[model samples]
Target chain A: MRMLRLLTVIMLLFSVAPTITAQETITVDFYFPTATATITNPEAGESIEAVFNRYAAAFEAANPGVQINVVYTGSYTDTRNTIQTEIAGGGAGPDVAVMLTTDLFSFIEEGTILPVQDFIDTMPDGEAYVADFFPAFLLNSLDEEGVIWSIPYQRSTPVLYYNVEQFAEAGFDAPPRNRQELAEMAQALTLPDGQRWGVWLPTEGFPIWLFSAFVIADGQHFVEESPSEVYFNTPQTREALDYIISLSRDYGVMPGGTLSWGDGPSIFTSGKASMLFHTTGSLTRILNEAPFEVGVAFLPSGTAGEDGTGYGAPTGGGNLYLFANSTPEEQAAAWAWIQFLSSPEIQSDWGAATGYVAARRSAWELDPLASLVARRPQYAVARDQLAFAQKEFSAYRTIDIQGIINSTLSGIISGATTDIEGALTTAQAQIDSLLAEYR
Target chain B: MRHHNALGSRVADAVTTLLSLLWLSPLIFAILLSFRPPNEPITNGNIFFGSTITLDNYRAAWSVAPWLTHYLNSIIFVVGVLIVQLVTVTMAGYAFARMRFRGRDTLLLIILLQLMIPSGVLIVQNFATIRTLNLFDTHIALMLPYWGSAFGLLLMRQTFREIPFELEEAARIDGASLWQVLRHVYIPLSIPAYTAFALVSISSHWNEFLWPFIVTRSESVRPLTVGLSKLVATTDVGALYNQLMAGTLLVIAPLVILFMFFQRRFIESFARSGLK
Candidate 1:
């Protein structure tokens, strides 16, 4: 009886003890820029978590010594701010970060991110695989100093999403091919009883990309060879601004309540608006959730003498960056994960899973997705827009000045001051003041 | 006319009850949401209208972080803070009530000034102080700044003054020292006041998020408030809503249970202490 009781106590002790005594797993911290989303017991290839799980399983299976822990911090901006603070404080931050290349230049200048070329050079198949990505995607991933930094994983550009029913109602067989057609179609599409507008722009968050495209389309320069100095005060930019403003005030074809925090895509999806100018990444969301049939159109053309023949959108996507602080072995492991993730198969699978266009050119040739893209046909518009896309080369203190741009852009739309020159002047002055520290 | 008066009063009573319920509706919704499945999207249809519920949210909430550790750390923080506060406030209250000293009224007024100044503006300064003391990332860091509360001192002073001087005189006649007089008579009589202060201090510290989030880096030291933020940030409507709601429910469950357990004592102490 005594022996049995002693045995039972020993068993209890053994069961309660932590199992960290063996060969410790190499924990690689992966910081993802995403807000949490709930998908119910997700089906295979149907959700982001499902795709993440597949990658994690395959990576872990290949490299048994490694255990990757994913922490969904928040949106792109939130993760950038958090990482900045963490780096400043000299704490144990993420070993790897997968975030947008739109903010890459600023992060590189601030020295928050470390270049991964040296890590890539030591890899067996890195040279060939890295070459598989499009040049534009690679350029977006490069730092201002022309050093290779992050690897492009997922990328997209904005396309015009139009309501098919509204287009038919407006007596148009297809999406408008030019700005003049779009404007004329907008006038035709506007209905009194429906109160549905023709075109809608987000009053916040997306204005920088749209404004940058406008500046480029109008043949105006933001800055000379030096990325500093304000140059957005040209006549061409003023004309572009006037055109967009007229789309709202003169045409009365833009959705109302945009200035007061209403969603443009939701408005488009719910048939409150006839058209929405947003990312191709929104394609899957609109396809999955919108109550009406949707159509894709090229971004509007500018007036003559402007580079308005084609829409000049920026290539926006998340990149996989390996941290410099990681051990040589850990770096190798992270590279392996990155390579696995960026492969043609994975890219194709991920693109099909999410709405994002794959960074790889080879992904377009894959079956089912290839067929889908070929059939829907308009999905290929993102590829064409990619040719004109430009990445942002924000100043060293882009973050502090980013909020200023977002606020000032919103201020422009609300007609708060109605002075484009004054807004640009004040923005320039603010940017200059911010740049003083970096200088 | 009698029927009309009766009908009007009944309608008035019904409207008042409805208004009370309308005020409580959000709290009721939070309670219901706490039991929802983790990761389910909440829609308008579900907001005022769904009935399918489960305990998975509660279970997920329980498992999300080192909640047991958070609860233990919270208890330690509240008890430690309360113990130190009780001693300081009692002595300070006794001094303010009985002793006529130089700058006494001026000093009390200065202390009361702390109540007027918002706590938010002091965060950066408090963080610097906590850092200087090597108390950052510790439960003590959270408790230290709030240990000697001005509000508690003022309340205790009022309660002490309400008591007659005869109690202290009786204790003095028994050859009791100043310490003994405070310990035996004054302390015993001030139970209601101390209880009122404890309820407030414990609940506030238990639910505080920002200061704790700023100070504590590790999950081990974080309180329920900071832990719940992780769950909130994770809960996008299309994913993890159930888990977020579950975690929120778990965070409040202990406090709710605690409040219920001490509801009678809480009401009595507040009533006796005369702090509405």
Candidate 2:
């Protein structure tokens, strides 16, 4: 009787399956996370969703039987978590998603993300198009064996933002070129009255600006050749950390938590901070809202004790990926959408509108916005800084590294660990333990 | 002697008003912040009593997404869950309250055990279950697990117990069947308990984030809290504070209004349950 019932079920599915496939339209859900802070700008304005919808509509017009539905996933982190849940559950996840590059390496390891090399291989101009992305961006998107898993959607490098008015008051004609001068200028501009602090840096989602500077300063490798080891407690690491710690204790230039969220970017906008180290992506937001004349410059060189050369901050942003769970037709439809968005014309427009750097070098030459930035000397600073762009080696458990750094840094700031050497040593011990687990 | 009584009454009135203000401060702050633009500098004195009221924030919040769709989805989700719960819990409560069967005690113990397990622990498994049923991205998926509440069952079972057995006997004697006895007598007598559970269920599911976030991927099925949180998390604060505040106020107002209207009944139900 059980066998008979099973035979009947199989027969029922066989009959019904063709009818389901005969449906005209294939619907793909695209989950988008809105910014955590409520954007006052209407969706009709400069938000990514507005641009996404325009592309979605255009894609639908070009492709028959393809309907793209966009849903708001809350915050960037929440979107990642939400999609992970869906994928883990073996349910319908987003066909394509915008995810932080910092997270890609780990996600791919867990078999959640589809490697894009196969998808790109089938396209006519896929190789050329893939090559258009900045070389530095490959770090986050590629595996140890160099399999491309995702395409760069948005990218940002940290730059120094200073108040022009404040700089003039401090008798500085231009932004400081190196770390020592930058610190001295901060001390010069800082007032005893609770009016302002000299410098601030956000410790939020992408604290890689500080981390990259530290790594580069210490001449430490972010990840070993095999992508297995992270050197967090090298001599350069200690020296770089000691300097940042001094900004608060020794220089008296930083008022804690003002420049940061949980120690990130709140200080600068509040007018309590004169200079902020933050992403170029934030430039648009600052321009839209800052009351003061903002000046942009490359991050100051971390004085290498002997060479006096400073390292560049790490690049941060999301990459677009096609999920493996999607149907072949749906995957093709998603590929078309991604290609349209990544086109030189579209990328340039997006880069101009939003503060994201253009992923394709070709877009920079052809984009009107790029030309506009070229005319402005300050924006040119970012273009020049791109030469030294670094991407975090999120391969060795990025979140764990951050946790160790945050706890150690928190202890240093709170004066709980008065000795930076001891605190950093403890942190390195923890990081080594984590690295050992991965081994 | 009468003067002393009057002074005590004044003190009581003063404390009540102060407490009320304290409870309402968050609402007041949200309203105040909603008027400021994102990234606009807000010094201590510029806000609070001195600032001009504005509607730009509300306009921004409305335009950010299809918030109206979110509201509709939330209503559908909350109502669907509550209605299903009303049936499932009432039936289960009736069973456990009146009916006697073999291993009944063991069965009740198993149901009670579910209450101790944290909801977070079940999320990944529950999501998998929903996927197996092919209910992902639908309102039905969001409502499925909530159809029966273990706590609601216990509360309703107790509520049914307090009613006289004579009522059930009278209905049965009048030629009413067991189903009719349950539907007509036990259900009506247990309205307060059901009302309590309804409030708890609706408010909790209304404010819930992860489950709906995980299950529903389309705006057509998204609840308001998720929509509101998405907007809250991404925007620049200085530029959009006022607008975010307005959006927040609109998102939370319905629940606040519902609470205001049902406060007395809610408290009384809880009080009764507490006694049990």
Candidate 3:
């Protein structure tokens, strides 16, 4: 009699709950870059994966029979490698993946990723969702054909990080506002005894990243915004490279070794260096880790942008792409997952939790970020710098061309080779050949 | 003279200990740094400061990815590959040592030549082959290339050759079959060689990141190395030194623990199975 009662209850539950048949279950493989495994907040190290899980749970509860698998594939580069390998190996990999915005053209060339519009155009709120992204972010997400290929996820720009105590001792009330001021200030703060160095820009980081900012501040773009023409051999570029080499070469302010982009923030916090020119993505990390008060300012402009808003720092970070190989059901599920992640509420918390600037303007008006800005204005600087922010080197083969330019710069700075013009000339020739087919 | 000799021996021990510590410094730093807090200054070159320590990094690292699945997958992957390797290597080694065969010397030369060929040189071909076999994302794909290890073949062949033929002859006279002779005589005495080979196989597979990363796309097949990297390695954000080290420590902890418990067998196996 007890067994009969249990069987009757089970039947009723199945009838009411809507039985999920195997084929009807939509499984979305969501692959994204791993930035903060834990919490991203400057004050509280929040578990980003936990937030993703919560978002996944909410989406699951609202829409029955759909499962979201949030797989944190290594770095942005790793995400690209995984996607390419799967597609080339003839396997349908993650339904959705995130990679650097500069990877758009490269993916387009591969012909593996679906345009975000493919799914967005089918949604009721598609138009508004498309319009909601900040124009600055939209600049990189859209291709030359005006078809949007990706959605801006975690975007950022480089800024100057300075030590307040070191500045006071150097007798400067304000951080340097231009290249000339930077050289003077760096000279004042420099101590040759190895305990503290003046100013250091990591030559060992990503190719064509921070140095591109200097090119923009000098009123020049490294590659044409559309990435068509070669500009490495120009006098303008040579000037920018000379100013960089002069710091260690003629000025004696920076250290003489190959410094890595990753080592910048750590070196600063350890009081090994006084100033660091690094990404605003590191703001939260520096705030949380540094024992001293940290001050941040716009990167000093070159002579061209005397007003300091000259074609500003280049933006660099991860953007979302829809995999083309997924089923219609999987794609639909992936579209829903993208919407949930890109929603204002979720993006707002994302900005506050992680140091990344929210991709949409509306997210800035939302609660925690709005309050975060009010309480700590330092958090808002990266977003404010967006007015001047330009897209990084996005070309047919972005990393390759940038690598050539980077290795050239590295040679000049490290004193391994002295002829900057000779190096740039060789790089210019390589760029011309690399871009010939693209043109 | 007695006092001087005692001092000389003490000096020699101290010198040897210092050299060992020097060789082990990077490992030591990784272990110690795992305990340090994120807020502590690690690059200031004072890694030994014990002002504050926390298990928060471990907690944070654990929550990032599915570590439980990774642990299970890694154990199954290494052990499965090792077991298959033992059987194949032992049998092949026996064939080379005792059995007469055609073109045996030429075949041995061809197999030994594989030792000079780096695994990286064949990645593209291996990947293509894996796809053709329809085993692209499976753990079996990861184990396929490594199943017939050239180094293992060489090691076992050398070990088998050192064993006396009298034992096998004695067993055969008792009317035992060839299989029975191997089971009773060769297998029992070659424990150290097998143990030594097993250690090498386990550690190599455990730490291998690149191939597993290429083959496995989902969490179901990911090993601890890939999982830990996904947890801590971010492009935009710099690594959380403590958390990264903690995750690394967690990934390496099992191997370290195993080595500690089986220190004697591990050392003896390698010493007795010294390179031919």
Candidate 2 vs candidate 3: which has greater TM-score? 3
| Model 1 chain B: worst 10 consecutive residues (lDDT sum) | B233-242
Q: Rank by lDDT, descending?
A: 3, 2, 1
Best of the candidates, TM-score: 3
**Which portions of model 1 miss their true places by more than 4 Å?**
A1-24, A39-54, A102-106, A124-127, A154-156, A220-230, A255-262, A304-308, A364-384, A436-439, B1-276
Per-model TM-score on C-alpha atoms:
0.72, 0.88, 0.90
- Ranked candidates (DockQ, high to low): 3, 2, 1
Ranking by TM-score: 3, 2, 1
Q: In candidate 3, what are the lDDT values of residues A248-359, reduced to their tens digit?
A: 8788888775677766777787777888988778888788778888888888888787676564688888887888889888888887788878888878888888878898
**Among all candidates shown, the one with the greatest lDDT:** 3
Give a tens-digit lDDT track for model 1, residues B41-82: 344345542346778666655644567888787788778888
Over the stretch A1-439, how does candidate 2's per-residue lDDT look in tens digits?
A: 9999999999999999988875668877676654423332221264567767777887789887888887667777788888877778777688888877778757766766788888788888877988788877766787778888888877777788898988898788898877788789999988886578898865444343456665764556556445567766677666666677678778888865313442224456657789987767666666555677889887876655224356466777778877878888888777777787788887777677666777887887775556757754565566667666666557567777877776666666556677888877888788788778667
How big is the positional error of residue A210 in model 1, measured in Å on the Cα after superposition? 3.3
Q: CA lDDT of each candidate?
A: 0.69, 0.74, 0.81
